[model samples]
Structure formats: C-alpha cells, structure tokens
Target chain A: MELEFVDIRVERDYFLIQGAGIFAPGIHLVSGRVGSGKTTLAMIAAGLKTPDSGRVKRHGIGSVMLSMQFPEQHLTGSTLESEIASWHLQPCPVLALAGLPGREKDDPFSLSRGELKRLHLACILSRRFDLLILDEPFSALDCREKMATADRIGSIRAGITLIFTHENQHLPRVDYLWEIRESALEFLGSVPDALVGWKNKPSVLADLHKRGVYPKNLSTADILEAACRTHD
Target chain B: MQDARLRLLTVIILSVASFMSVAGALAAFIWWIIFTPGIRTIAKSPFALFFLGFTASVSAVIWLTGGDGISYLVRMAVILLLAFYAYTDRAPGDFLDLSVWLFGKKIGFDIGLAAEMSLQGMEVLSDEARRTRVAFRLKAIKFGFRSIAPSAGLMIYSQFARAEEQADLLAVRGYRGGGMVCPQFTRVKGDVIASTSAILPLIFAIMPVGDIFILLQ
Candidate 1:
C-alpha cells in the first residue's frame, strides 16, 4: 500500500504547510519542531482533514486509523472493559498488554495520563490497519514505557505507518525519514542516508554522527550497536 | 465599544429595539454596520452556518403557518447580529469590570467570576467537541443518532474534569470570595457618540409606526 500527497497545502493562521511526498508500506518517521504542523500533516494523511489545495491519494489502502496526540480525546467508554471493547478487542488480553489487567471496572478517565496513553496505544497497536498514523505516540510516556512502545511499533511489519513526533529519544526503527522545515515537508530519503540530512535529530544521533558512527536505523538498539562499534 | 459598560448598554438597547418591530430591526442593522466590526466576522464564526440553517427552518415553518415569516426572520437576524457583536467585541475581563463597577465588589465580583468561567467553559466545550468529532471519525463511527449519547457524555465528563482542575488551581492560588479589582474603562469620543445615538433606535421602536413616518416626513 502507498499514500501520496500531491502538492498538499494547508493554511493555518500563522503558518502554511505545503508538501508533496509518497509514503510506501513501511514505518516512516516524520519529525519537526513543536508547532511545526506535525499534527496537521498527520491529520491530513489520515483523511481526517482536507488540505486547502492538492489531494491525498491512497492506493490499495482500505482501513485507516489515527491515534491522536491526546489519549483523553479518544475516551468514549467510561469503564476500562467498555473502552477495550470499543476497539473490538477482548478486555483481558488488551488490559494485560496495557499492564492494567483485572481493572476492567475502573473508569478510563481515572487512569493516570501515562497509563491512559499506554492503554490507548495498546488498543491501537493490537489491530492492523492499512494506514496507521500516530501523532506524538511517545508523549506523556515515561522512559520505560517509551522504550516499550518503540519496540512494539518497530515489530509492526505490515502496511504503512507514519509516526509524527518531535521526540528526541526512544524512536522506532524507521524505513524513511521526513521532516517539516520552514512550513514545508521535506523528504530526506531512506534511514541511514537520511540521518546526515536530519536537522532536528536527537543529541545522541548527532554526537554519534560527529564521531563517524552512523546508525543503520533510529531504534535505540541500533544506536547502541553503532556506539559500541570500534574503528579497525 | 472599548468601554464595556457602554458596549453592554448598546447591545441591550439594540437587541430590544430589533425585537420590537421590523423598522427597529432595520435601525439595529444600520447601527451594527456603523458601530460593530463587520458581517464578515460573524460569517466566519463556526456557529454561522448552524445559525443560518436554524433561522431558515424556523422561517419556513412560520411562513407555512401564515405568520409574518419575513418580519420574524428580519427581527431575529438583527437581534442575533447584535448578540454576536457584543460577544466578539468583549475582552477577557470586560464583564468583571462591568459587574464590579455596577454592583460593587462583593456580589458583583462573584457574578463576574461565574460569567468569566462560563464563557471560558464554552470555548473549551467547542474545542473538545471538535476533537471528539475527529476521534469518532478515526474509529469509523458515524456521528448520528446512535453516537450522540456517548459523544455528549464524553464532552460533559471532560467539562467536569476541567472544572475540577480549575477549582483546584484557584484554591491553590488562595482565592477567596470577592477579590479587589480597580475597574478601568476607556471611553473614547466614538464610544460616547455611539452610546448617545443608540437611544434613537429604542425611541423609534417604542413609538407608533405612523408617528415615525410623520416625524420622518
């Protein structure tokens, strides 16, 4: 499956987001500074928003799912059981995966923001979609939860996944790298090659790059491997 | 309009005048064009389309029942226009200043605080509703008869949560009843002129139609 943005342009009050790119069936990491239209691009890609100009054409994509930045916005069910059931998943397995097993009677809103985000991510990652757009997936997550979420995202080997984040640490293994610079989305080619052109890269990646150690992917494990490599 | 007291008084006079008769509506419309920002502001508002659809439906019903649908439409439209003008022209602490100025600090301060919070709540409610709509769309759920209950429940629950947070914040800030605020207002020459001229429409509205024609003649 492939998703294409044909000269898409969205005009907000302050800035204009214009870009054209193709997203193939793999994990794509799109990064930008805060208030840099990351959420806008995600919404446009997920078919939840229409751009002022151009068109988004989805090829061979039947179902689409967007995990918004705020997990509270996705709360439709009062209780945990009903919330899990809202996603058409069994409560026991999903709750266990979210590390909240047997708390089905508890209210979803009563959960801490981190716990709610974990539950929301668990619900989303459990199912497969042709086009999955996650906006700021690692937000409100602790360091451990962030690492676990990255691993889970990296294991999804099917369809197209677009992760929009400005998160400097704990990222999934990505196939392509893109960023929004000066209100326009710029495609920076595939992973390892794209790392050199990334402007807002994480400090660790930049330090490694300065030392001539370019990681093969953005995952923490890949970075660790590159960090431990010796020049023979 | 910079003076909250004058603006509020103008809004009240224009609203009541517009509701009294079609001539009053016409006068209010004229006042709106001259004093308020413009029609484009109201047109661009999110509620503009909803208001248009509602007015059209009500007008159609009135016409079918042999009532003066045109007059009803004109008057209501003008009144709504005045209401929108008042809403858009208001600054954040306008009501607090006006209330405290009129009713003194004790009772007036409490009312103003309530009004401010309610207005803020409305804004938050609108934002939450938009996000909820997007969330429902993401889940492949059609927002219709079946989804209204859940949607409303979510919005109401969020509002309560937000209200509780605000209360906690206020308590932490050591907020007690009736705070002191030296109400300040800027009454420009235009404000005085507009306030003086706003009385004419009310007089025209309250007088007989024949008298207005004779006076005009």
Candidate 2:
C-alpha cells in the first residue's frame, strides 16, 4: 500500500504545519528544527497522527507500523519474549537482530536505546506492513548498531516507508528528502541526487563545493570524504 | 532551557493519559511525543501509575467479590502494608525518582511532587552555589579542588543554617503547616487528554450492556 498525504495541514498549541505530502517506498528522510513539525508530519503520514485538515490516503489495503523514536515508547509487550513473539513472521530472529542476543524473555526496558529501536524495527519488518514509520531511528545507537540497522533497513521491502531523522549521513539511499522547515514540507529529489547544491548541506560540504569537487550526494560520508580528498 | 521543560512535561501528561486508558490508536498517535524522550529520559510516573492501577484493580475486584470476612481481612492487611511501604525512609529524592521510573522518564514529572522538587532543588542549589562563589572570592581562592571544596562545604553549611533559621522564623511568624509557593502550572494539550482519560472509565463503566460482554472474563 502506498501512503499519500493530501494537502495535510495541522495547527495545535505551538505546531502549525501546512500543505505537506510524502510519497513512499524506499527510505525517506524527514528533517526539521525542534518544533518544525517533522514528527507531526511523519505521524500524520503514517496514520498515527491526524492532521487538522487532511487525510492519510491509504492507497491499498495494508497495515501500519510506527517505530517510535524511543523504542521503549512503542513497547506494549510485558516482556521481550512476548513482544518479539508478537510479530507475525517468525519473531525470534528479529529479536536477535535487535541486539537482544538472548531469547525473548528479557524485559524490553533493560535493552539499550539502539537495541530497543532495532527490536521495534524487527517487529515491524517481521510483520507485513504496507508502510513503516520510524522516528529518529538512530538516536542512541553505537556506531556498529547504526550501520547494522541502516544496512538491515536498506534491505527491507514495503509499500511506503517514512523515517524521521536529522543525521543525513547515516540514512540509507532513499527516493526523497522531506524537510519540515518552518512547518512547511519541501520534497527534494532522491537522496543522492536531491542533495545537489542543497542549502542545508554542511559547511564542509560547502567548502568541498567551493573546491569544485561536489559529490553526487553531499551526505556526511560524501562531504567528509570530499574534505579529506581536498586535504590530501 | 527551563521553558523547554514543557516538552518533558508533555510526556508525563501523555503517560497519565495512558494511565487513565485513552489508548489504542489515539494513544499511539501521541506515542512518539512521549516515547522519544521517555526511552532516553524515562518517565517519573510509570511505577506510581502501575501502583495506582494495581490498587484500583484490587479495589474493583474486592467490590465485585462482595467482601467476605477472610478476604476483607486480607485486603486490610494488604492496605496496611502498602501504607507502611509509602512512609518508610526513602532517600531525599527517591520518591520523585521512583515516580520518574514508575511513570516513564519523559512523563515522570507528572507526579507534581517530583516536578516541584526538581524545580526547588535547582533553585536551592543555585542559591547555595552563588553564596559559595561569593565566599570563595572572599577567601581569594583560585579554581582548584582544595579551594573549591572548602568553599562549597561552607556554603552548604550556611544554607542549612539558614534553613534551620527559617524554620524557627516560620514558627515565630503566623505560618501554618504545608509548603511554599510554586510556579503556576498550566495544563498543556496532554493534560486535557489525561482529564478525558479519567472520565473514560466512568463512560465505559456506564455502558453495562456492551462492557459486560467484554468485561466477562
């Protein structure tokens, strides 16, 4: 199932987001300031949040899975085992994938932040969801877990997927970069391509661009490597 | 940064709502607002909520069971134990900390006591620290452990002395028992949800026909 945000707009006590749309399949990055409504937009897109005046058009019949920024937030299971076992597909492996190395009987709260996130994702992937929404999926992950999760998610297939994050570098290759700036949604092109002459490109990237060696995609890795190349 | 406590307060608000059972999809909708910080910060109220839930559940069960003498004695014993447990010597801040752990971190401050203590602790600490700094300068101290520790100790001593003096002062004055003033707490969007959650059980309890079908274990 494809998820569509049809002119989605919202106005709450402090948040006022308007006219935003996110089309999915392949990873999508949502970046915004603290209150720019990046989360609000992601929530609305994933059907977890309702917009003041828009509809989440679930294009096909599908289930919705939301990976909360804090994996513990989504933990409804009493124990790790039950939660892992709660998945539709064989839930065991996903629990392992989440770095919860033992069986599912552990307390979900005992796992570290990254482990919890991975566990949440494993649950999402093990099930068949048309769309999976992950909020700040890499917040507390160590370097290894970060890359491992990126690789794992990079390997998955779903109808539409939305990931909210600020770390532009760690994200897998994606179809679009949706930025919530001042509560407005701006859809840049594909991740690698969308970042072309991107305004939000880091200072190092700007420096690289000045040196006439602009990357295909000016992500963290691309920019850092370009900086090193220029230095060398 | 202090104003940003609102966001943290948001979590407690939502958890309280969850505690009151405004859950399923609506709870899921606001889940991230609570979850992101809560996973990282942990809530202050989860345990308290759990205890409250257990108490409420037990009360409900007792009400249903029609209060036999043995069961009534058992229930009274349990209540006495719980009351005793609440009054035992807790660490200075453990009650708030427990509230935080119980509720989940983000929403931990939902227990008004924890939030109030947090703010008061900061204020008192700040006053003490400022007084210490002034004393340190009077002693012509530089930034080193030797100079700093003595000054800090003196400052803390003075703060305690002042606290005792204030207690005496309060006794001399026409002060009643209770506490001091706190910042006015305005309910954010989440508090409204909690209020609604409180009312929800009443609504559910009233729907005898459908609720009985679901409640029939």
Q: Please report, in order, the local distance difference test score of every candidate based on alpha carbons.
A: 0.89, 0.55
Compute each candidate's TM-score over C-alphas: 0.89, 0.51
Instruction: Look at candidate 2 and tell me the lDDT of residue A94.
Output: 75
Best by TM-score: 1
Q: Residue-wise lDDT of candidate 1 within A51-78, one digit each (tens)?
A: 9999999999999999999998887776
Candidate 2, residues A27-90: lDDT per residue as tens digits? 7766666656666676676555688897778767466666656554443345677555445345
Model 1 / residue A56 / CA error / Å: 2.7
Q: What is the lDDT for B30 in model 2?
A: 39
Off by over 4 Å in 1: B33-77, B104-107, B180-197
For model 1 the TM-score comes to 0.89
Q: What is the DockQ of candidate 1?
A: 0.54
